[model samples]
Target chain A: MQTELSGQLGIERAVFGFTPFPAVAAAISRAGGFGVLGAVRYTAPDDLRRDLDWLDAHTGGRPYGLDVVMPAKKVEGVSEADVEAMIPEGHRRFVRDTLAAHGVPELADGEASGWRITGWMEQVARTQLDVALDYPIRLLANALGSPPADVVARAHDRDVLVAALAGSARHARKHQEAGIDIVVAQGYEAGGHTGEIATMVLTPEIVDAVDPLPVLAAGGIGSGRQVAAALTLGAQGVWLGSLWLTTTEADLHSSALTRKLLAAGSGDTVRSRALTGKPARQLRTAWTDAWDDPAGPGTLPMPLQGLLVAEALSRIQKYEAEPLLGTPVGQIVGRMTAERGVQEVLDDLTRGFEEAVDRINRIAGRSGPS
Target chain B: MQTELSGQLGIERAVFGFTPFPAVAAAISRAGGFGVLGAVRYTAPDDLRRDLDWLDAHTGGRPYGLDVVMPAKKVEGVSEADVEAMIPEGHRRFVRDTLAAHGVPELADGEASGWRITGWMEQVARTQLDVALDYPIRLLANALGSPPADVVARAHDRDVLVAALAGSARHARKHQEAGIDIVVAQGYEAGGHTGEIATMVLTPEIVDAVDPLPVLAAGGIGSGRQVAAALTLGAQGVWLGSLWLTTTEADLHSSALTRKLLAAGSGDTVRSRALTGKPARQLRTAWTDAWDDPAGPGTLPMPLQGLLVAEALSRIQKYEAEPLLGTPVGQIVGRMTAERGVQEVLDDLTRGFEEAVDRINRIAGRSGPS
Candidate 1:
């Protein structure tokens, strides 16, 4: 059934769901909200193109969006050759030794065993963006920072809406100045890289500071009441991440880790930089503990750190035995008690919103005029 | 300058600082650490008399203690008779009218006024305990929930050692089963009434659920070393409350309403009905908007609901302007960015402990590995 959001986005619910696994993008589009596919994990152009084609074919003419990570700052944007040269032999040896200490084996013989620091970095991300634009995608979003000016201009040339993630109001203002159509005010409680400000305070501050700009609240919001609270605080919609990680349809492969998350409480998580060299809230574990140790060499900058640990992470996933080797998830992971369909999750949000509205009304009921 | 805490109670570091004027107590105990005058505004019998007298006499003796309210649960055993009899009819009318209109007046005329709860409560609080027992006054403490059965019996019967405030862990395991030497774990984040549980996970979960006891870690500890992360996570010494209010010693009478706490990095305060049956935290004006809503049934329970209205509080203070009438305090209030007699406060705790140790440490700090 088409809904208010569907009219705005020209997307049908059924078509939206079969495409995106977590069904978040589909569920949102189905429920008249927009769904954007994250394109950070794909390292190859063909893999990203295949996913985009699948989404396009399955969406059944419904509009969808694509998200890419183009962080504003990196290791001073060293050229591919320069970054390759900067990777000292000792650092590479340390990475190998650390993995070996953890009982992880080296890559099979003849394989491209080591990934380069700048190898396929911007090029791959841009390729994904280009591929999505080639399809019927209506929106393009950047996670860590603003899309490069050319990317923004190219998306605009195609009449696609441009969005960017902002941790603070200042960041939001910059995104707006960059001709971005939407700003995702991701609070510290969010699953991915986040700023230290809380959603409760950050939402309104961003709304007021970036007046007249459409803002979406993202972070510890997993329930409908939280969504309602965000909207009440002036956000137009909510961009949820962790709520999808536990969905049965999500690409989550670790059953043991998923079970542990289902049983955890809201307090069990901590915001640590063991994952992406940025403060991302995740399930606290020995892996994060090692990074937090005062004696250990601190995490490196973004892409470099991600590159350093990607292979180790890949091995951790292959074994599926370590609790600390998973992708970063938000504090809301504590609320994922079961693996349900995305449709059910969307229904829950709707119900929660209605209930919150009712409660607020009850609380605001008065004996006299306002 | 070495006064005993109680009879045989050797005065240890003066750590108590919960008073309308903490500087005085902090000053008297200067070679030690600092002393706190318990509930400085309560209008009851044993209020300021004994403690002030002891403080005056022991000016050169050593540092002392002051205890006050930092209750976790508001009113539990309060009988209907107590509630009905204690609150005056005019005050009840004010509550009903305020609820009906979402507005509270600042003060009442002659007939409607007496000890309406704020300053008077502190006045009575200041009186109750005997400041002199035998040993020099070291630390003053307030029990939020029914004071330890033998606070007076043990402290007075023994002759030294001032007791202080507690919130949970079964109220410091019933203050170590009644003979509590020192136990205060206030967690509501300063200002009147607390208990939302946020001192970075309630200080080591009330310090390993009250092991050897002899612990003190109030809520919202605001500092870099703050008893250093060491004492708070678990330590034999650490007690702080409302140290952020006004501390010039010269600005004691300044408008309490004008006093403001500095912007604390951790904005995790919660308002609960631990003290007066209402939630309270030291935020700016936005708090009044939430608390003064007329649509709500005017806060419920003891000291609380009554304390919600600004006017009832104003009448109690009787100042021409709002006097910021409140009590207790939490470590979080240290955000009040002002500096004053730093030497005097530190000296009191140090000197008092040295003298107490000269007489006692045969067992103190020698209790095996922490």
Candidate 2:
């Protein structure tokens, strides 16, 4: 059904569905290539199963993917409940008091669901994986590290390709060694948990190190010339994440937020762990500034940090008044001025790729068949 | 006495000297990294010989080097008569007509003698080379391409290391194949002729491609982090050019030009072929704009294009009132805010390099011995 992406997923233009909304995922699948639903927000197995079913019905079985944050290294094997318990009483009080101070109401009695990042979290991820396997998902990607051995084996058993995101060539090699199918070399220019290395240097080094394995270049790729340069440096396909976040189909908070992104340039983005408790490239905002302030309490670990402010973040999104609510976005966001449909975006990529190929060939002095 | 450029030349720092003046060439040889006079505007052999002799007298018995343009491909041969003959009378008339339209006067009868790229230009370059060789020059660097085979042989016979400027990995390979001793991978951010690739990408690629040959990363590197990044990416050393242009020792045209450069940012510079009929990055000024204007007479090939506007450029420099007369400078000019001595500049680079090394090692978790 999807000819472009079916042969080699790396060659396909995959639109990452960062939202948990099934409709958005389906729309991306309909546009061609795969769509990936962010699975961290979904709590229950049934809730995830429902979303997966909704996506299948809406897209008529177009292949999509599922993404989860299964970090390999943490403080220890401390269970989710144990980690929750480990959070100091003062910190929890601070969160509640801060929300109160900010005019955001606290959850009603018995509505408070404590958040954690441990074995229970892993179990939830495994359960979601189990549910997603029932559908026609062509790929499954993990955000932080190599998927657990069982997760890889189960996906392989279902004939689904497993891919992982890596910040460096060393990380990419570890993924390849672990039998991962594709390595997404995500550079510092990328949004969401990036490294210090810039895209220009990282891409070629990753490509050279991970020979024979299909690699996708992910970073500040917003134009055809960049895509062409990536291919010239040996990437099989380019993975675009931030470029999609600003599209017409994107479920942004409000018009003001979108306008802020439009006004920003490539240099405006900063890599800070304010939101995710990991170095993630995001638009600089008051929230980031507050976290960055030396006087404030430092950020906590992954899921713990995310859990602490999830409700506050929910309020921020609901109000859409604060300019600091925008999520992870790459440096390429500077070039994304107008809102366009996914199909239009794909067409632009195709045109850019063709032009870049032509330019490169001309420079190489090879006009036709040798 | 020179202390910074010791490894390249075999003299002690006390014996050699490094200065901003062209005469520093002999001082550097007396102290040690064999200082070479920058020959950007030296059009006559007599002018160059006079400077060379002045250096020779200033630093008695010190060896130095001579740098010149020997581009592999130029617009035309260097014989003054042949080049003048080759310039179509219509083109000359057109240039005169254009200058007249701009209310500029035509050059006086003998004033146009030094203009044009001719075989005699090569003869002038050889003359300077021979004059330097007559003294004890330890090196001869062709600022554009591989030194002509005979030129290389002459330098080698005199025990001088021959070096060349390369803008890409392919260009570096060409220099290596031609038996050049050193390959300087100058990135697009460089002030002079450059390719489209940035230093971050070009440095490592050139380092990897030209194995066994020491690579010096040049371009937009004005600090320690950049220098560290270059070495981390496999460069042996850094060949700084733009950073020197704003130093207290630098012989600049006007305070206004220096101020404009100081106020610019890393992104202010643009790579355009407006100056030398080849892509050379510079502060985008009116002079470059006039040539870049799509409606204007398009730039001619090297030497031809340069020859066409030589007098106009000289006038622009002489008047110093035209914004179009901005000199060539790299993106690093943005950080070149304050005036500092050459020694201070060297110290800053050393400090920056140390900090970068420390930061990178800390990130890699290898700050201490394994």
List ranges where model 2 is wrong by over 4 Å.
A1-6, A9-21, A73-81, A89-120, A368-370, B1-370
- The 0-to-1 C-alpha lDDT of every candidate, in the order given, reads 0.54, 0.64
Tens digits of lDDT, candidate 1, B262-334: 3332242334342356555543333343344544334456554554443454442445233233333443443
* Model 2 lDDT on a 0 to 1 scale: 0.64
Worst 10 residues of 2 chain A by lDDT: A361-370
Clashes of each: 77, 16
RMSD of 2: 20.1
Model 1 segments beyond 4 Å from truth?
A: A1-24, A72-81, A84-98, A110-120, A366-370, B1-370
Which DockQ values do the candidates obtain, in the order shown? 0.02, 0.03
Per-candidate alpha-carbon RMSD to the true structure? 21.4, 20.1
